[model samples]
Target: MKIGEVSGHASVPVETIRYYEKIGLLLKPDRDASDYRVYGNAHLNRLLFIKRCRNLDMTQDEIRELIRLSENPEADCHEVDALLARHLIHVRDRLSELANLETALQQLQQACSKTGTVEQCGIMGGLSSELGGLSDKDTDQRNHVPGTHKPGSH
Candidate 1:
């Protein structure tokens, strides 16, 4: 099969396949007499694996490490477990951060629910106010000014 056919079968762009090859993520395919890149079942399988890893939100470096481990089938599986554990921790942290952001946005939305002039808007008032160096309980302490009540001082 040609590069286009392989990409079509994998449901990925031809440019992506070429980029994977360029980045050494995917092996370069053999060329025909006309120099058209030829692909085989092995390439297709590898592309599918890469796609699955991407869907799992694995980084390129993580995927590279996985591929290396896959090549060495005799290697212990404990390292793979550890890698996944680390990735899970990162995902959990991101989820917690997103939840906090959602809460803040909800509060902002509530502030805007009441009809008023722009200057009288609670959301704008909160944003524009100096807060007198006051900080929210949820605000990161690292950004808080010592003995200050300002919200945006950081």
Candidate 2:
């Protein structure tokens, strides 16, 4: 099949498939007589596996490692177990962080319950205090750090 055919069957975008090839996650497909990319069942299966791994929020490095381990069918499952355990811990940490973020947002929302001018807006005052590095001591410092980016950065 052609690249587009495989992409449609696998539900992965063509650009992503090309990127996977570039990143060494997916092998480059063979070309036809017209130099068009040709894909096969192996590519489709691999693409599906990669998509599943991505859906699990696994890092590219982790997916790569799993793929490497997958090549050796006789290898012990301990390494895979360890990797999953680590990922679970990371997921739990992110959940906790998200919960804290929600709480912080709730507190910020409650700062100004009534409608008013910007000058009298408590929410704006809290945000301004945060930007000025004068945030309340009770605020969650971990999630409140302002992110910085260079101009025109994605």
Candidate 3:
């Protein structure tokens, strides 16, 4: 099969598949006589695995580590358990941060009673007020949501 075929079967974008290969998450497939990429069942299975991991919000590093561990069928499963536990902790933290964010936005929205002019917009005023600004700790807490791009990523 071709790249497009595999992508459709995996429900992943073609560019994402290429990116996974580039990042060493998915192994590069062999090329046909016309230099077009050729994919097989292995590629399809790997892409599906990657898609499932991504749907679970696992990071590339996490997926890579899981893949490595999977290669050794005889290896102990403790590492997988540990990795999932760590991921769950991160998910919980994000949920807490998101709840706080929702509360903050609600407060900001309540600052204004009704639709008004820009000058009378309480939400804007609250955002601009130095006294109402988020503290450094609050800012840090809000900034680390999952899937946020960090420095040095492509």
Identify the candidate with maximal TM-score: 3
| Models sorted by lDDT, best on top | 3, 2, 1
lDDT of 3 at 154: 10
Task: Kindly give the stretch of ten consecutive residues in candidate 2 with the minimal lDDT sum.
Answer: 145-154
Model 3 CA deviation exceeding 4 Å by range:
130-154
* Candidate 2 residue pairs in backbone clash: none
For each of the candidates, the C-alpha root-mean-square deviation to the true structure, in angstroms, is 8.5, 6.3, 3.8
Return whichever of 2 and 3 wins on lDDT: 3
If ranked by TM-score, best first, what sequence of candidates would result? Answer: 3, 2, 1
* Model 1 per-residue lDDT tens digits across residues 1-154: 9998998999999999999999988999999999999999999999999999889877777788889889989989998998788777766765676777678668876778488799888888765663555566645564222312223211
Q: Which residue pairs in candidate 1 collide? A: 133-148, 133-149, 133-150, 134-149, 134-150
Better model by lDDT, 1 or 2? 2
Candidate 3 per-residue lDDT over residues 1-154, each given as its tens digit:
9999998888889999999999999999999999999999998998899899888888888899899999998999999999888788777766776897788789998899688798999988888994566575434342455333222221
> Highest lDDT, which number?
3
User: Looking at model 1, which ten-residue stretch has the lowest summed lDDT?
Assistant: 145-154
lDDT (tens digit, per residue) of candidate 2 on 11-95? 9999999999999999999999999999999999999999999998777788898999999999999999988887777667666
